[model samples]
Target: MGGQENVDYSIVICTYNPDENVLKRCLQAVRQLNVANISTEVILVDNNSKVRVQDLPYIKEYTAGIPGLKQLFVVKQGLLYARLAAIAEAKGAQIVFFDDDNEPESEYLQELHRLNKQFPNVAAWGPGNVEVDFVDGVDDNIREVALQLFQHRTATTVGFAAIKDWQPCYPYGTGLCIKTDLCREYLQQVNQGRLTLTGRNGNKLSSGEDTQMIMLCISKGYAAGISPALRLTHIITAKRANRPYMNRLLYGTRSCYETCMVQVFPERKQMLESKLISGAKFSRQTLKKFLKTKWNRSPQKTFDLIQFIAAHASDYMALDKPLPGFVNKVLTSLKIV
Candidate 1:
């Protein structure tokens, strides 16, 4: 299923229930990537999917032609667990992460390989994404926000740029490539209850795991940046454009910000709280929108925001002390569908 113990790159693609046609196209794109003699392996970790891999037409039909392709089913639900499993099994110095929906360019692998060679001791780097809105009737305003949500851009520099200050720490998980050693280090912190957000377990969208990892790496003297050499097409279908998912996305984004701040700014505990309190409250219109569908408040929205604030508040209280059960529980909790 994979190459020798030492490979130039191990491309990890983690997924839940994926669109079959898009999956085929992505696999085909992977099959066509120009590794150019760089030892590589493509590991597809099915994260507790309901669909059997054996029954998936794309797995049987499309990936037969994809060399270095390995399929591993992860019964664990969260993306963090799937990724932990992937890191344990990965045999590459650099592991490039790709989402199932991303169609990386022909030179994606080669460029990542080049970047790894270029930036020694670099933790991770990723190319910006081109968003392909796959839904009709998406208004310009919605499209604008969706573009920012899906696309990861670097303003300071695009190619091998060192992160001198704390800006957007890393790219989104799509087309994000990291060194295997750093991935292991990041997971160790996750085990220790430091970084939160940035994982998907079924319906729970507590995210920023990617950002947290890169931020942690930077704190430990690792170099990370946005690379222009690599590129991928990130597909956002109509389903994600709906109201419920949009709310989840917004909540997850803020939740991730809170957790990441907790990890990186443990000293500014009171200061963080002040900022949160001083921040603008939810508008009347926004609250009405949350209440329109139901007589009461939206439980999902309420819980998500509560968790977000609690995460930061808990960390603020903890300071250097160990975080208790409650903070980590909500961070990793699965939504009871």
Candidate 2:
């Protein structure tokens, strides 16, 4: 049921109120990518965007000549929902989840295909060269933090060993190339309202949907890894490097990680409860650090550190709030929420 389909690759680009200029760059990258003999399809999902993607002049200007380019509008708001909406429509045996900011190398598809053929158990694969292109004002520290903010990891993780580089990431969502059947299975989980974590939605800056899917595959003895040859550049903006944005990004990411943690480790319920009980103590320590570091080294660093600590506490305390999603429903069912 996978590669039996005619299409070789279905490139799914789901965007929500994206930067038009960067989105244009992404489309251009796709247009220029060397597909050669690959039967590729491009699916653009407008995730209820404020500015419809098709309305953008570049929609015609850039993607006009490209074949198999289709426009899809996902009424749902979340990034995961957008991908899920496109998955049902994808005819290709393989699907590559692309962000609007991604600029793939010419051989992106060729490289992924090469690796997939080399490793059949690989359910989801990504590009290793997928990285952040920081804007001007970014120094080394800020750039590092910004990369962390986006979960762009350079380390290549192929299987269960992939869990080590989980610095809030496994393989990034930018150029995630996955098998169709695995994508369908993940989509089914989404349809059943299982996974409580939703990926980035709008400008909220949260994540975890990617990791959950990969982890699910791993649980089933499938591998999630990277093809070093396939490359993609993530266009960065100054806003993502700012202190306030980092605070929100890290805070939301913390919630994402905790939610995914519960799903991936259902037996850790008692541990999560302990974290909830000690949340106040953690918050107090974070406040103390904030007070001391307010006048210390880089205010942004000091403040971001505080947010990192407080984010964990916040997720712990909010363990009671009912949300629309849950990862492992059986485990979460016993939650006191």
Q: 238-306 in candidate 1: lDDT tens per residue?
A: 767555565556556554564575676566566655554211232233334334435645444544444
Question: What are the per-residue Cα lDDT tens digits for candidate 2 across 179-274?
Answer: 888788887876787666787765666667887777777766776776557678888777566665675666666666656655655665567676
Best model number under TM-score: 2
Distance (Å) between predicted and true CA of 330, model 2? 33
Global Cα lDDT for candidate 1: 0.66
What TM-score would each prediction reach against the true structure? 0.77, 0.83
* Alpha-carbon shift of residue 101 in model 1 (angstroms): 0.8
**Which candidate should be chosen as best, given lDDT against the real structure?**
2
- Candidate 2: regions farther than 4 A off: 1-4, 135-141, 151-169, 270-277, 303-307, 314-337
Worst 10 residues of 2 by lDDT: 327-336
TM-score of candidate 1 relative to the true fold: 0.77
